[model samples]
Target: MKQLTLAGAIAAVCGTTFSSTAVLAQPSAQAADQSEIMELIVTGSRSPERLDEVTASVTVVDAEALQQDLQLTAELQNILSFRVPGLAPTTNSTSNFGQTLRGRTTLVMIDGVPQSTPLRNGALDVRTIDPAALQRVEVVKGATSIYGNGAAGGIINYITRQAGEDAFNVSLTQQVGMNAEETDDTASFRSSATIDGTVERFSYVFNATVDDNGVQRDAEGDIIGQALYGLSGVRTQSLFAKLGYQIDDDKSLSFTANYYDAEQVDRLIDVTSSINDGTKTYAVKPAPGQTFPGEPQGVDGNSNFVLQYRDAQLLSNTSLTVDAYTQEIENVFFYSTTFADPAAGFSGGNSVIVSEKEGLRLNLESVFDLSGVEATFIYGADVLNDVTSQPLADVRSWVPEMDMSNEALYLQSKFVIDDWVLKAGVRDESVDIDVPDYTTLRMCGANNVCRGGNPVEGGKLSYSDTTYNAGVRYNFSTAFSPFVSYSQGFDVSDLGLLLRAASVPDLDQVQTEASVIDHYELGVAGRYRALNYEFAIYESESELGTATVENPPGSGLYVPVRAPQEIEGWELALGLTVNESLELGTTYTYVEGQDPDTGAYIDARKIAPPKFTAWADYTVGNGLSASLQWMKVMNRNRFAPVDPVTGRYTGAEAPVEGYDVFNLSALYSRDNWRVSLGFENLFNEAYFPARAQAFTYAGYNTMGLGRTVKAGLTVEF
Candidate 1:
């Protein structure tokens, strides 16, 4: 009989198994020591466990990997696209539209504090925190309810840096880069500093970062005007601080605060130059008095505060953890004239959506020796209140304020016997949303005819569901491990959007039902000599999957389509260590989804074509290391035809042509000084991303960035 080893499973989950030499390259001594012990604590696991002991498909990117060559970009979407196999490609904008994981929206968090506004997704959650402020990123694939609502796809948790045992430590980093082809106005600069130390029973870590981005240009030296209004030529600043106090050896308390701000500062207006030859181009014009020059977009401001307490030994073999957090987020979208109603005492400007959340979470875990089997039981409860609203600059309410409250309770048990591991969990969730009576905003049609302002009565909606999951893994030997799992997840629809556009007389009449998703997976992980590999096949089904559809063609009026959907996919990763100085790795991902009713692709733009990524790293001694990486995407012709004029897919489908790119990076470090250089799009390929081509209707058809070079240096004391 062949069984899987914990090591093999961890290798599979990470996509690239790190060799001993690679692990030794970690920056932190504590992390290196933990790697030696093979004890890795993961988010969503409720407790610390060995890598092999984890049953779910989880990917952990440590600080070293996060700073790797191909992942040096400031955009989180770009980094994740190249690293995570199941995630969609980057939209090249601040907004992560259609950037789903496993074809569903993922819940994003920072140190257990939610960043996503599920009540009304602003698509800006992924960019809330600067990558430099993170020590590690954990991604758990597949639908799971362990962390509560909005995890229909999976969860992404960003763990912040912690203070070391040293009395005082300070680090500083600076970088400057420019476009290789057009360097005139395409220069960018970034600076970051960190101070951390441990004194007596108190430990503290503080970090600050500032980034000034220049105009984005393509291979042809043309400015990429299709990007989000506030993405290019923008300034971003982030501040983070964490303080912890050790109360004896069994108890600890921590406080964390983070603030982020991003705004565009360029004074260029977008003027449509041409829309032909399967692409569009925009010229720059001087626009005064405009908030964002080209567009009336505003800044993005996000703030978070958290307090946590943990008791490792409240009782013998028992532990408890509690967390309280509050977050405020405001995201502004590009200006739109569609809602301009001068007759209604309102002139359309940029619209902004605000979301505020306050929550408390509690978890308790206990280990019990039951007969001959060792079991670990975990339970937790969560209470959260979210308030969200969308309003125009003219003080007109586009979407009225909505208050939502959620309560959840979950219980999980894990048992280990010999070479077998069994796990089961269940969660009960309750949700309530309140909407006040209001009149719809007056809107003008394309023909200059205005109609709207319909009175809608206030209503309240409540819903509840119970989800369950089970998994079993057998480690038949040190060479291989195989596992099977079934899990369920649920998400309440975007209530704020639903209520603001509600036409029904009563809330009960409207479909306020939550969508339930079920996931099934079979996976195998194995190690042979210096080679490690993992493969998984999975299927997800949702009876009431949500899809966006254009109700009136060319009118831009869209509505949600509730239909049955099924998605199936497979993932494979391989890693080989040729020697202590050289290593190679590769990953392949394939996913597809279909609507059960019409048998057509559901949200074609959301589907990522088959992708393959390969990388090689080598150390040349003298504290120097270099790496090369390549990524290729296969052509996806599985979509309906597009309308010539509107550029909208007739059946919610559009082709995504494929492209490949190469990258190179080198690093040199000695003593307290480090230097690094990275080259992106090494081949200077002139191509467009799938989203850019598929969304030509919005005049967003633009080419991707060309070859670029970046260099940075870091100093520590």
Candidate 2:
């Protein structure tokens, strides 16, 4: 029952994000009247419910906090990195390669529409939408069956911004940034426009953001590489629009669309360096006769559309909601020698993943009595179609096209008896996938050893499961509530990882079976006057799970391996509001996972190291406010630093050295104008992030970004 509202999830909660305290710390009368900001839960039950009553762990980053986040960085990965606990840090590139939620893939969504392509898992879902277009973000913790497939960890939903009560409103923002380590050719720019209005029964909101980035450098003033997991010289643009129509007091309809694109423009080649040599890779301009190869690496495009209709009084006390959605996305990866075949006519190769999804959801909620105890029942049916594939651009097929159809029906019951609240839900899901006969592209590692490119007979695959969830909460007093929960999640877990590396003669011989995760959680929440707190512990396990492993050791050919795995973690959050305009908060998080059969701790690629985060914000009534945030990742020594035989730093076995970072932001607003200034990586700490150290790859050991500054101005009319 850690159903703390985004505004109340405070810093004191370990999994609570920084924005938890920010919403309540706003310069508003909310500090005096706590009830004014009581947020309604949406993603928790797939319906609007009271935050304090939801029987699950959820985190929300409200609008005010999202605004504060934008002032600091434009990257969505960076926004979620320090804000959400349990989630791994950003790779600081176009890819979310190592970021995970509780050591598993989290289904990223926009308005209940899935964005993750688990079939191929390009790890680009995190950046599909811009914060400027969203009103808030909701995170549901632990395994879940709410939104079927790829939710082994949980879900992150980005709620679109809304039209305010104002009859008409418009806001424009422009900002520029540069690396503090060195400024030459390092200036970045961003601009956004938002318009919203309400007219009688109609309301609409539109937002657009354009971002142009420049060369990025580490604390040592070396240009960050562009070969892999690099962010330098990229351009990103986001467009979002939402229109709502109220047919009557009891019925409404809405349509939403969002499109995002990012691509590398600047020409910079990576100067590969070895982890064994204790050297960092850096980017450099090409020489006079040198030229780039392959296609520019980044997101080619991502588009999403959703249409929703609701009736508050469809029949008697029953309510109904229907949703329709469509999505398409393509993620392009960097050119690498990992897919090269020296004996063939290939030098090096790059690949891209294309996914298209269409789905429909129908839900109904009814109120009734269950044996004299007040109860509510929610029932829903979902149908989805997804087609995904991965292929080397203009070359050959890697992962053949997989057409999938999914159908699910679920029912949830909630009972309220005096001071006790109990809830349970069950979902029956069926999935069918068809793959055509194809040949796995031949690939060569750095050692010039060839593998794959064999013809595999394809056929139809079917999966079905019944997932269940139950939880109970006891509200003893206004200050304390504790809850226990159990849930299950089903996922196919990167099917393409298996298909592309297929040495099997046929699809039947492959381990294409789905994975089911069992999740358990116990948590408590308390609020005392101006202070709020939350604490939770969780465990997730699977009989057949998947993880990225460097096959054959030191081959640089990473593959997903199926194994029995278990993950456990705990979190705590605390927030204190001093008077009406000052707030202080902090959180601590720890997570770990292992293979039950081998009894060995998982690699850092999946599990995040322990973390500590703190923040302080103050509002000066005179149109000025400032906030400072800090984070520290603890040392992760799960594996040895070097290989026993080669004396080389083993991939994914390199020891991870921890580091700390700080950020500062200040904003001033008067009349119709607002100005903001922010600093990232305050004090310019020169260090490698957890993933960079643990990855132990030639070009992936890049350093974290150096100190950076951003200044922006906004005008309203």
Candidate 2 on 310-397: residue-level lDDT in tens?
9999999799999999999988888876677778877887789999999999999998877788788889999999999988886578
Cα lDDT computed for each candidate against the true fold: 0.73, 0.81
Clashing pairs in 2: 11-574, 11-586, 12-573, 12-574, 13-572, 13-573, 13-574, 14-572, 14-573
In model 1, the runs with Cα more than 4 Å from the true position are 1-37, 69-71, 226-230, 271-277, 281-299, 345-347, 554-556, 642-652
| Model 2: residue 70 alpha-carbon error in angstroms | 1.1
Estimated TM-score for each candidate: 0.92, 0.93
Which candidate number has the best TM-score?
2
TM-score, cand. 2 vs. native: 0.93
In terms of lDDT, the poorest run of 10 residues in model 2 is 16-25
Among these predicted structures, which one has the highest lDDT?
2
Candidate 2: what lDDT? Answer: 0.81
After best superposition, candidate 2 residue 224: deviation in angstroms? 1.2
